[model samples]
Target: MIINPELDKLYNVRAAIPNHTDIFADWEQRSVEFSQNVKGQLDLRYGKGPREKLDLYLASEKNAPLHVFIHGGYWQAMDKSQSNFLGKTFLDAGINVAMIGYDLCPDVTLRELVEEIRRAFVWLWNHAEEYGYDQGKVQISGHSAGGHLVCMLLATNWLSYGLPTDVNPIHSAIAISGLFDLTQLVPTSINAKLGLELEEAKLLSPLFVDPQNICPLLLVVGSDESSGFHQQSDNLSVGWGENFEQLDRMNAVNCHHLSVVALLAEKQSSLFQWAIRHLGS
Candidate 1:
């Protein structure tokens, strides 16, 4: 493992959070219960890969705006199953929710994972009519690595992916506790699993990519998260300047990395309120 002391402390979230395992377990159990209790299509495949599946839950029988969520595990660890609970608040507010899944690293490169996410969106757009959602009113949000992916999605060239040049697949996006620049992580122990070379890391970083459109963006980081996460968000906002129609940044009070994302499950959370307002707009 690469042993850079400063970077390790800044990015090694699991090591810093003593109860991270407990948090994961709670998220898992709650998600499983929520999935069983909620009515939706489960394990719907978006791509041919075994892990390339998503779960969709609509607010009602009517056609509604869609909220797509991507789970974060540094691109190697979590699953959409742990993210199912996030759909409840949005669903309660009459928005349809889709939790996306992608093949993890070591099994597939990070670039491949990004392509899979893009493909998932394309699939969603193609099936929007059948699924009863508004194709034009889609918003996306992600936590941690998923947040990184959110920025990548913003940077995507939809036309190159076969979407018409006039169409914007994403209306707005939220990145929670996201890593924008990945070069710092290369020398850290976290890179041991990711296997990101220096050039690939730079190329994959959202900080370096030119955003494809001027969509609204919300950047959120936990108040108690490490300095590295705060730095990443700050850097990204500046780096992607003027590219987004609206760029708002927030700090989830008294919360750590994992706990901040849990705020989405709380109906009264500022995070959820902001989401509801933007999604309805």
Candidate 2:
């Protein structure tokens, strides 16, 4: 049976054009207002290039665990400000939240974007102590494209950065409706902007990567999300086996990709509670 009616709306390789425009506009407006509410020091740095600046929202407490959240938009859309709503959950839980912004695709390659995220994580690691965060207690979470990035971070070699080989910068990862494999999207028009080749797709897919580290991972997906999204989560879970733990799926009570963030904003939600428990431990 058909699972995602929204996916049915797309006539060709292109996404449902109208929905894309509407969602992006909503994100832009939300991000603008969210930026205004940020208090304390906000560090903006061009870590990789002219456009590659990381925007960090520091919480009032210094000794709290840090939650690094990455935005979605299929790796081509969305901005850091659009995801500011996430700050409320972790902040209320007595944890500091870091929202990351990366250059969108078609302008910069996905490989470059992934590397940029890696660099941002390193920046966070180097500055963790100064920021009053426990580098050992860091948690990484992302939605959609961000979710893909979270998985990529999990697969990285911590030893290469002079960090402990046993130390995974990301102690726990909360990946919501993440796309783990780029190969599935090759047939879609997103590939036009993503510029994915077969070889590149295989190399970048987190599902294909080995999961040797045993980090607790929480994979969440809206019940109403597309079949492709569900498949992505399933593939990652299968690939990681026991290294992935505390797997929780949320139907989100009538939520879509955009609406899921509202659930995340609710500190009492399963996703938020699970993340807090993991980060606290």
Each prediction's TM-score against the native?
0.97, 0.87
Kindly report which residue stretches of model 2 are placed more than 4 angstroms away from their true locations once superposed: 1-30
- Candidate 1, residues 34-113, lDDT tens digits: the string is 98889889889999998999989987747789999999999999899888998888887889999999999879988899
Segments of candidate 1 deviating more than 4 angstroms: none
The top-ranked prediction according to TM-score is 1
Report the lDDT tens digits of candidate 2 across residue range 22-86: 76577667666666765634546738565566656666677678888998877887677777766
Q: Which residue pairs in model 1 clash with each other?
A: none
lDDT of 2 at 172: 81
> How far out, in Å, is residue 272 in model 2?
1.6
Error of 2 at 91 (Å): 1.5
